[model samples]
Target chain A: MSLSDAPGPRWRPAPLLPRDEEREVSLHFVVAVLCFLACLMAVGGVSADRAARGWARDLRGEATIQVRPRLGETGDEAAARAAEAVAGVRGVTEAAALEKQKAEALLEPWLGKAVLQDLPIPHLVTVRLDRAHPATATDLKKALDRAGVDADVDDHARWLKDVERSAGVVRWAVAILFSLTAAAAAAVIAFATRAGMAARRDVVEVLHLTGAKDAFIANLFQLRFARLAAVSGVFGAGAAAAVTALIELVGGGQGFTPALPLTWMDLLTVSPCPLVAATVAALSARLTTLRLLRGTL
Target chain B: MSRQPTPRAAAAYGAEEAFDPTTGPVVRFQNVGMRYGRAPEVLKDVGFTLPVGSFHFLTGPSGAGKSSLLKLIYLANRASRGTVQLFGHDVERVARADLPYLRRRIGVVFQEYRLLDHLPAFDNVALPLRIAGRKPQTYRDDIAELLTWVGLGHKMQAMPATLSGGEKQRLAIARAVVTQPELLLADEPTGNIDPEMSLKILRLFVELNRMGTTVLIATHDQDLVGRAGMPVLHLNEGRLSRKATRRAPEPAAPDYGPELGPEYEPEPDEPELGYDLGDEEGEA
Candidate 1:
């Protein structure tokens, strides 16, 4: 009879770590919470970035002309002349004089509607520039001066710069948050591995005495943690996605449109969070097991 | 069989003369001393040579460092102070990667019977072969045959916790000898078994020794030692001494009697028989 025809022994090494149901549940909960927070931070950072870009794009070629009432000229007349002057500029596409009430309404939120009418608000002339042929703020101001209108030209560049700076800070914060979460998860897995090794010291010693290699023992732990991390990551990602969808729905119900609308693709970005968590867990477990084995044996 | 030159014999000829490897001992310890970290030495100035294919019993009371000596021979414990040579190569000089290869040639039945409680009797016996990277199918029949010879065939599927103390001891012996190691170091092989089972286990070791595997069994059972009629290496308070020999007439055959049955024949092609086993005149 050949060796292949003989019956084989049916025995496998029991898992080095006993399955602690409570501990497993707690770990999953912790990992899921971290993952959710990370996903939310990612989404918030990306949305802020898109909003800042949109604001920059819309304000790029636009300027406003504010006219003051001269001694003999009415505010309306000055604004009309300024608008006409802006229209004749090289790259100005359309210029219109703002109505007195509409101009006062712009300040209504800060100054109160009752106080706005009595104040001598500047007559505002809004100008839209042809994006293909942009006009400089200096040229527009020079044109307004020649038209006998005393007006100040504002290009909204300072506001856009502030927005971009805020967006950059948010992005950095989000990245830091993601890194801290990953590190925390890895720490948890490493601690768990150490405890498992201590608990299974007898089994490990026997295996070692029996000539089992360090790599063989480490692989068992690494694979277990990786699987647990993956499952927890998925649950965490799902919860975060649900929370984001709820926020979008509520915001939409309040007649608010997001700066950039949420799409299926935006939600799909959270899918990789679990994979990242799993990698961290596996690496942590492997390193911890090897280090412990080296020290003990 | 030829014997290796002992340290005393070598010293008489002066240290300058080198020993030949072809006829050297299977294990040699020269002034070996061992201690745990920061602890007093457990074994001191231990020096001996187990010539190739010899059988000896290590006898001492509890805490006499019999186990520690076995550890030294099996490469589990490195001597704190002296040189240990196994298979004619210095253990201290052997690389860490090569230690496992050296350990494979030595089989040890631990005093505690260290069987995996989770594994069945058959798998426990098959452990050494498995560790040696033999496919299970390749060693299945051999494991079954060995387990049966140890009288554990009925308990082949039994877990260690379910087995009796005697069965556990037998299983451990089975595991140790499964790979047919060149040197077998059994720490108290018959300590927990009945006299009948003890004799059977000793016979198994005797049969293994006859097949050219060197055997060293450490036990405090002086009766068992006396019955075996082999050379005794006595350890007292961490000191070792070789007791005088008592030779008996060689038996024509090892008549284990009708109790063992005809199936218990030692393989005829075994290279050498270490000793002849004869029935005691008044035993039956």
Candidate 2:
């Protein structure tokens, strides 16, 4: 850093603007908190989406059929015929007639065995659909109609619709949370820029009247706040990621809860947080500085 | 950045010759009026001209608007009314983007020695050149030479807070002249310094003036004005008039304090007063 070095040392000019240290630290804290909340929102959104899809998948894979005996056939024979028809359909992976024993088991809790034996129980069939291209309700109806078996099919479409709607709502809430966090960060940066200008008005005045360009003075605050925001963003993202990892570690395979699961891959989503924070800070600082300079001059 | 040096020519208000910078004044003010943001005018109907290489002392009491007039020269404030022409370009017509370039051609040494506290003495001195976009390698030696000339070579690395008042004043001077501006304006350059330092600053201005930079110093020190032996543009209560001659015993101007010990005196052969200051002083 001395002048006597080999080639005259490059004159690294000192920073033209100074940040009041206490306010800068407080600003860092506010921005870091916003970033952490944003990361949590992002991770929560993804997990909720996965949970909804899982519920829908379970509902889609299984369908139940209620069978009424034909005039000449017994209830068991009718149920077996229905299963055979469904098994021959294109998307049915497996189908079987529900035996009387399993049917009794399903009804025993609601009705005492003595009353169940006296009552005539309905015969039933269970069908498994291929997950990738499950059969639609219309397809199942058409197949039953072709077999001439008197039966009603229930594909759990109502439950699937409700799950999808809940997932959509979660998606919207996460987007709003993320947007609010970004806006709060921008506001903090703008406030810091204004405070910085107030703290060093004399320096700005001298630089302006001394023929320094407006861009030169503005660049000073922009770079300073940008660097600060980037560091804050790193801390925020790191803390969020670490907390998520801890949850995953404690909860084993199905993390935290089945409804909202955390996975190792979700941490990658937070990697760009620091860069986003820095960009927002730079833009906020630049606009604030230009407005102040133009207004004051 | 200043307009080319024009021929030493004179023009008065409403003069009917085609205006030419190649032959016009370095600065021309015609019926100029200035005020700060809707306030009452502080300067009114002022007119003057400084030709190339002229040095003048602007002397008045504290409320005489001396600083306001200097602001108009340095492009810190625009005239509220009338014409202000600097280096032959009408300031009103200059675009906002061009104002900084125009200011680059003029150097200002502030009353407060507005050196930034964070910068070392050398960086402070090198600011103007840096703002003008000169490379550090090109101006580094020149800065050292200028600092050495101003008695600051040994303190080049010292922060501004560490320097004494006189040292700060001289450091401010070095910053102002690092770019070798065509015009130099100083506001109360001697107020906070000792008498010896005051004389040293006066000599620096004289030397800068000799090097063809037009110089204007606003001060309350009667001794500095008398010792420099330059024409005085006396401003009083929003009005301006020139003394035009330096012969001592200025009847038209305010009393130069009898305390200005025997260094300057009235000359018997000098006329009563050369300025058209009229019967106001006659009554006095």
Best by lDDT: 2
The interface RMSD value for candidate 2 stands at: 4.4
Q: TM-score, each model?
A: 0.78, 0.84
- Per residue, candidate 1 scores C-alpha lDDT tens digits across B166-272 of 89999999988887888899999998999888889988888788777888999988766655666777777777754433233335324444323232333445223
Q: Which residue pairs overlap in candidate 2's backbone?
A: B7-B22
Worst 10 residues of 2 chain A by lDDT: A1-10
Candidate 2: stretches off by over 4 Å:
A1-8, A57-64, A69-77, A96-126, B1-24, B243-284
Worst 10 residues of 2 chain B by lDDT: B275-284
Candidate 1: segments with Cα more than 4 A from true spot:
A1-26, A47-63, A67-97, A125-150, A253-263, B1-26, B94-98, B122-145, B210-212, B243-284
For candidate 1, what is the recovered fraction of reference interface contacts?
0.11
Q: Tell me model 1's lDDT, rounded to 2 decimals.
A: 0.75
**Each prediction's DockQ?**
0.18, 0.28
Give lDDT: candidate 1, residue B37.
Answer: 95
- The TM-score that candidate 2 achieves is 0.84
